[model samples]
Target: MSGIYIHIPFCKQACHYCDFHFSTSMKKKEEMVLAIAKEIQMRKSEFKNEIVETIYFGGGTPSVLTSAEINFLIAEVYKYYSVSDNPEITLEANPDDLSSERIIELSKSKINRLSIGIQSFFEDDLQLMNRAHNSAEARKCLEVATQYFDNISLDLIYGIPDSSQNGEQAQQMSNEKWKQNIETALSFGIPHISSYALTVEPKTALNKLIQTGKIAAPKDDVAQEHFAILIEMLEANDFIHYELSNFGKENYFSKNNSAYWLGKKYIGIGPSAHSYDGVSRSWNVSNNALYLKSIQEGKIPNEIEILSVMDRYNEYVMTGLRTIWGVSLDKIESEFGSGYLEYLNNQSRKFLDDDLLFIENGILKPTKKGKFLTDGIASDLFILN
Candidate 1:
């Protein structure tokens, strides 16, 4: 009802740090697109009575798809479901795939928002991560994209491995270099930015590279330092830290993701995408071959999980703590009962006393100093799933 997330599972090349589900081969791309449209129609009954407010295109690289293909899937959504009058439709795209011609063509489509993946403007960072785009392509894409799109968001990766001198893992990124990265992004005058640290997940190319001494690992301390600088710089430029990893100017917050943080129901279509209702969660199979096979047979290959009370409580505490809208005490007591609220209060006592968490009015929120540690604190306050 609130949103629909369509996962495009094809990419031109692999990024070392990415762990999302995708495939490099485009042999089945056409079939995949048809299957996605079919799935969208199949799930229409789920939201028959609800108006869809947002539709997000996220994936291996949504930009890899042609404008016609993208529009076809969007057409399927409109045919099957009741969409909002002015829905927020977002497409997640990579820099290399967003050529000058491509950007102009996309501007004519129904998509109203663009989430560009411009991880960094430096050659070292791009090459180290094996990004398909060069630094020039990143800058060029934004220059063209900004001219046609008013609603745009940039993705920046901080705390990238910085050991060019000798490849030492503990060595931190130069403070000035990190500052420059932030400054370069600000020059574009974009409305929103979603930044994150470069984490090393096991079995990924980045992880393997680090294990074989091909690249240095990202340091937590460096990430914290970069995060601090990011907050200071973005806030000074009139951006609000609405969520831990998201910053937006006035009237520019992401409607799709906001719904998720607020625990609203939405459906995910395509291979490896997830869906959620108020009481249960579901996900399509991650394997593209299997997903296509089942969809062609008129069945959605998905697994469902019914959430228990404790499971719901823990999820609430986790998501609620990460955003500007803190957890509501009254809602907790009324919805989850007094026992869970009491347990939360007891578990959060240490955090509240230490200034890591605070109670303002009736909501519990993290302090500036404690913002980065919100996840850990939230986990400690969980009701036990």
Candidate 2:
């Protein structure tokens, strides 16, 4: 099935470690919203006759938009696209923007799911991350959101070197606190979670702080420890470890992201968003004003890239290995030809023998050890030609 992704490129504030395209100054909010609605009508031919099972409102923080605005956007999609009967409409919200009343209002709209950005449950960690929410707000928002939607997902960040708790808590690194957060979410019977390790991108405020010795760099060991904990904890809670950084209860997986991993097609609107067809991918310009102006002129500001055989092969390997389903050798052989499949099998032999990967019924799957070096392994398996 197909999907639709709408990127809202605005945030209340920029996080120290963020490199996403967004503007704190919301001068173009109205213009951008109108542009997005127009874009849906403009791109109707892109997904003609394709039943859309997922609609994701990802962003600089989708919660910043009013319910009325959100409803208008949904109406536009319905007016143009052939959406499924029960499409999963998700909004990415920060904790501070969510309230019990706000969530109730959101529930009345077409939004069926919520992906809350609760980076951490501790005030100190929030301060370090420069998140717009406090610890109390993070906890309270989840409780309130649960009352409105059972299909809720939480996002958490771990492995920040600045995170610490003294005395009894000092015995554990900051990552351990994430376990408590997970348990709290489980208590609420939340359906999904996306956990990631803290990463300092170049040119970000976080990188500058580390460069100036105002903050410590992320530790590899700490990240590994947290990753291990995350996998074990989610598994114990009977959550499906669907993707590398995502877990979901049965039948609650993100259909939008799942479509991406499975190589299904989708259309993306708004700045800094990417779209995929069967054989090619494209991305919109990252500049907000540029995106608005172009769309307003009845043009989609995007660059397209037709995938070379090698590019498609490499992407298949990379995305497949990150999910629990793994890569199917037969599909690879059929799609890329037997020569490419043989090359992958030969390269995977070493990993298979070393117990880093296992093959079952023509499917190549990674072991726990292999998961840590997934990207490297995928790179090696790629056919450069």
Candidate 3:
């Protein structure tokens, strides 16, 4: 089944390291939501069968929308698409927006999953990232949220301002202390977790701070070490490291994202979101005013690209290598012809010999060592022709 993604391009405040297309000014909230609903209605035929299996509310912060706004948006989705009986509808929320009343409202709505952005449990780290929530609110929201939903996921930021990871005056948190954060969520029976290192993206406020010597740059070694610890700790807690940055226990994998990884078709609504079918990819313009005005004029301000054979091969190599499923030689042979399959087999030989990759049941899977360097290896194996 296909999926749908809606982008809410407004945030209460900007996180220093974020580079997402969002505006802190939410004067256009009502207009934006209406436009998104209209966009979905206009593009209803994009996916032949409206039997959608997943719907994702991602954004500047989906939580920024009021409960009434969320209800209206979801109603529009139901009107436009034929939702699955058991659809996985997820909303990306921040800690500050989640209260007992809001959580109860969300539980009663069609939304079945909550992906909370509780980036750090430390007040200082929250301050460093310009996160709007404090340590107490971060801890409290989870308590309020869990009382309503069982299939919950949370985000955690690692390699932040900490003496443990080597910040000048930051308190040293023990590895056990790091696990404490994970354990707290797991205790709530959280089914999924997405954690990432604090990356200083170019032109971001965090990058500017590092340049001005106001904040330190993240250490790669320290980030890697933290990642290792995170993996070990979560695995011990029975969470499956399904994707590089995502972990899930039992059957709680993100269906919307899993569809993307498996190369399934999906449509995206609103500004700055991407849409992909097997053969082509497209994205809406990131500007809110322009996006709404164009859509109102019966135009989709977007660009599309039809994938070439080489492009498809490269994409397969890139996405396939990131997952536990790896690249299947049989899949390549069937889809791209035997010549391309032979080329891949020959190219992967070096990695196989180095113990970075292994051929298991004709599928090339990455070793623990290979996972860290997947991007480089995927590039090396790309069919440029």
lDDT of 2 by residue, 166-214 (tens): 2121232455476776676677778898988888899788888778766
Cα misplacement distance, residue 6 of candidate 1 (Å): 0.2
Sorted by lDDT (best first), the order is 1, 2, 3
**lDDT of each candidate versus the true structure:** 0.92, 0.87, 0.85
Best by the lDDT measure: 1
| Ranking of models by TM-score | 1, 2, 3
Flag clash pairs in model 3.
none
Instruction: State which candidate, 1 or 2, has the greater TM-score.
Output: 1
Highest-scoring model, TM-score: 1
**lDDT tens digits, residue span 22-127, model 1:** 9999999999999999999999999988899999999999989999999999999999999989999999999888989999999999988999999988998888
- Per-model TM values vs. the true structure: 0.98, 0.96, 0.95
Better of 1 and 3 by lDDT: 1
The C-alpha local distance difference test score for the whole of candidate 2 amounts to 0.87
Looking at model 3, which ten-residue stretch has the lowest summed lDDT?
A: 163-172
| Candidate 1 positional error at 219, Å | 1.2
